[model samples]
Target: MITSQTLRQESEQPRKCFVVGPIGDPHAAHGSPEREAYEHHLGIFEQVIAPACEKYGITAVRADGIAHAGDINEQICRHVVESHLVVADVSSGNPNVMYELGLRHITGKPTIHIGEAGQLPFDIASIRTIRYQRTRSHLAGARKEIESALEVGLRDGFELLTPARVLRGLQSGDGPASVSEIGDGANREDEDSPGLLDDFAVIEDGLDDMTADMEAITKTIETIGSLTEQSGAEMLDLSEANVPMNARLAAVARYAETISAPAGELNTVAAAFAERMVTMDSGVRAALGLIEMTPPDERGEGTEEFLEQLMSLDEAAQESLAQICSFGTSAGEMARMSRYLRKPVKEISAAVQQLTSAITRMGEWAAKARALAHSSAT
Candidate 1:
């Protein structure tokens, strides 16, 4: 007895989508690299993501566009969890972008990934990323690809990603699968399963990112420290040789310029890593809450499998924790050597502190998970 108007109303999809990616430095001087990066990413949002979303009556909002003045991280997390859809630019594998994407994935909502043609990370290379060059033709094609992907997502509804599927006891013994296997809406599961598995997947991915970023950070700090030491030696040699004051000053200026890019990258990545660690801690707490609320009888026959998965995650976290702790100690030493690079070093120290705290919380969650599984097994 339902009319066409009523059917249309019932089938209407939500129209808000949050975009996650690098926005670059807005206050960077004109004609600088930072300014150019800002413009380039902004161009992608306006010329690509916006037009594609407009086709489906969706409004795309970036984190920077929010008009409110509360905590930016809080606002971003809210949009990530509450929005009907999320589109993440995975180019350069930015840590903050990955963390936000992980958050969205935990919700099992509609999400999309896009990136520049050659910059996608190897870890996520198999996922369906809408790759685009800056050329007009490529950008146009990318926009169409996004629209088509969105059309499919809207029609078929959100399916579980690989990590979520495996943790939910839905898919057994599979490593991270390609987007075609899980992301294309081919495999749908029961909605009654506990959401704890979702948080597990999020933490799994976040830990992987944390480990990788920490290694990169360690290498960067070492390189900066070495450069600073070498530059000091060169300056001393120039002075001892009675080099002109103007020439020495010019050499020092050149050395500063050489150090600038890596220093800036270190700051950006460290800040993002700190934010992600905070989010990871929240995920751990949420998982522990789920463990407390889920009774053993409700887990059915999959309790053992769930325990195995929980143990696997704990092992992986332990391995990553070792690497992180090593980096934390080495980075502090390197920072002491290169005191001129204070800003980025400070950020690294802060990130290391936050990550350690998050891992400690994760250990607590693991203990609770083990106990829960033991109760179910007995």
Candidate 2:
């Protein structure tokens, strides 16, 4: 069999993903059967599912990580919105899992449902569930079954996944699949308009370039800072020497100050980029519907208008992330300078802190932006 590392490498080659079952049961704390069911399900994820993902080059992020707070639901919504496929385990008819699965079905992404043998819920008995005996001996068989199911599900493409039944399952108050139908109509209208997708791609590329630039600039700044600090320390020692050494010290101070001026400017640039990055983060979230807009019930509500707004937000976010990347590069340069400069111990320490903080923020912002953009695209 292929190793987990090999599977991870292959999975990394493709960006598609799926959200599986819940991680924990709330009722487990109360000693309820629901809790046991949750545990049984989690075992499937940890022992069987996670390993299988490693083998197939698929990334499986569970809903449990995001569900501890009320934010679990939001996380589920986000994953469904972004993932290319979803595999839902509905063995015991868990309400939360079913609800999320329903959302996946509506979005029209490829979905595969699996459940333990003899435990299939009545409502979904018509849908096939891969059967597995809950025993150590059955694990290998279960793994093979899941992997095959995933490959087939992915091959079917996203269109087959968005059935009317699935959409109906997710609609509020048992409403019909009118929302999806409307969405379909809007998609048809935009079918010939390639500009939307193109514009989004452009923004994404711009952001990537900006991030690379920022990283480079920040590295340069850090190098210069280190050099300046070192020179300062050397000058201090020269100050204690004879006249010739003192003269050398004066020259060193002048050189250090001159080099530091550019570093200071670069620091400013980095800060400006940080501001832009935050803006991009907000924009991406807005575009992805993580942030609320006017209610759907508002006057003049239409799907096209909503989509237009979402696209606009995505564009803006992309721009902001790009700017952030630019700033991060400059900051990195300053950090390197700090490492080289050998200045007063206090000042060097402060600069080090600044560099560290800036780099950390840039990394975090980049991750969030990427996640947002990716989710939307899928």
Candidate 3:
């Protein structure tokens, strides 16, 4: 069974490990918060991912470090699906990172999950993830863990994670099977010939992510609202006390500064949500197209289940749309108020503006989803 060609193929090429995580804003200025976060992630790559991968003769590349000049999203998705291994840092549960990791998970490939201690998302908590603190020793431990996992995985082969394995089992008309039955070659085959259920699974996973993001957004919005109200009341009291104009303006500016961090965070989270919205929109259209192309009688098994899931998603999308509209209104009002301040805080104004824009785009995506769901129902 061992052929020369296979041996040559194995020896000739080195494996690639795609590093997926928050790269931070590329254009963020040095010493700025955004740039600091960017540098922090770079440190992790250099200190943890690179050294561990080098030990196994694997070349590790992150999305930002890619040299070729093409569509970035396209390139990242290609790497995620085609890479021999993936090392995903899920510390903050960044939406874009989660989306790419979800794509990799669908392939049932070798993936190593690592994250900061106490920051792992609940959705993926059951899966084994290497947790590390920011200390040097912790980072070293993470690197060693990655190396050990890679060594065992490459030698004996990797097994599918729970979600993908269960989905594949369902598609195969068998309940979840042992690793011996669904691992390695069977997983590769499933990746190569994904069925309708698999496509639906992708959409469903995205919806779940979107739902969780919306909940977090809602809480953020509420927190900002509370801060704004408390600050407003304080400002009114200062005015009633016959405080000097300059002092009142100083209070206002300080309040703007107080809310600026939360506003920026909202913008970042909203932007990521918007990216996922675009993906969900494309996924919805693609799934709808497939359904339309199939004849009703030949729609095959699971058609009813697919439609039911779509209906459920439509309901969730509707709820999310309403929440987004409300959040947009709140953000717009805050932006306007910030601009009216004597010493306008450009940072807060700009952040809220970006958040509003992202929310608007999400609203459009939600509408499109509803339209597609309606069309499919009829």
TM-scores, all models, native as reference:
0.51, 0.41, 0.54
Q: Candidate 2 overall Cα lDDT vs. reference?
A: 0.51
Q: TM-score for candidate 2, please give it.
A: 0.41
Cα error, candidate 2, residue 281 (Å): 34
Residues 1-378, candidate 1: write the lDDT tens digits: 322233235434535779999999889999998898899999999999989887776779899899899989778887876676788999998877776776666555567889998899776686778999999899999999998886665555445565345445565454433333322322345686454554466456676776676666666667766776787789799989999988777766665566667766665665666566565654554454444445777654544554555566556556655654565565456445444444554554565565566556556656867887777768
Per-residue error (Å), model 2, residue 340: 99
Top-TM-score candidate index: 3
Tell me the lDDT of model 3 at 115. 96
Candidate 2 ranges with C-alpha deviation above 4 Å: 1-16, 26-35, 67-70, 153-159, 162-189, 192-378
Task: List pairs with backbone clashes in candidate 1.
Answer: none
Indicate the worst ten consecutive residues by lDDT in candidate 1: 177-186
Residue 235 displacement in candidate 1 (angstroms): 43
Model 2: ten consecutive residues of lowest lDDT:
177-186
lDDT by residue (tens digit), candidate 3, 1-378: 322233235545666789999898758988997898888899999999999988867789999889999988768887877777789999888877876777776656678899999989887899999999999999999999998876666555565676566545434343432323222223344346656556477667776786676666667666766777888798799989998988877776777777667666665666666677665653454454455445556555665565555555445545545554564555456556545432223433443454455455445544544554465467
lDDT of each: 0.67, 0.51, 0.67
- Report the C-alpha lDDT of model 2 over 1-378, residue by residue, as the tens digit: 444454345433544455566556655565677787677777777776766665556666676655356665566676765665566777667666665665454344456677778877776676666766789768668878777765543343223432333322333334322323322221333444332223234234445554554555456555655665675566566767645944774665565566565555555554554555443432233333422222333212233333443344444434434443454444445445444334332243343444445445445444554544444445
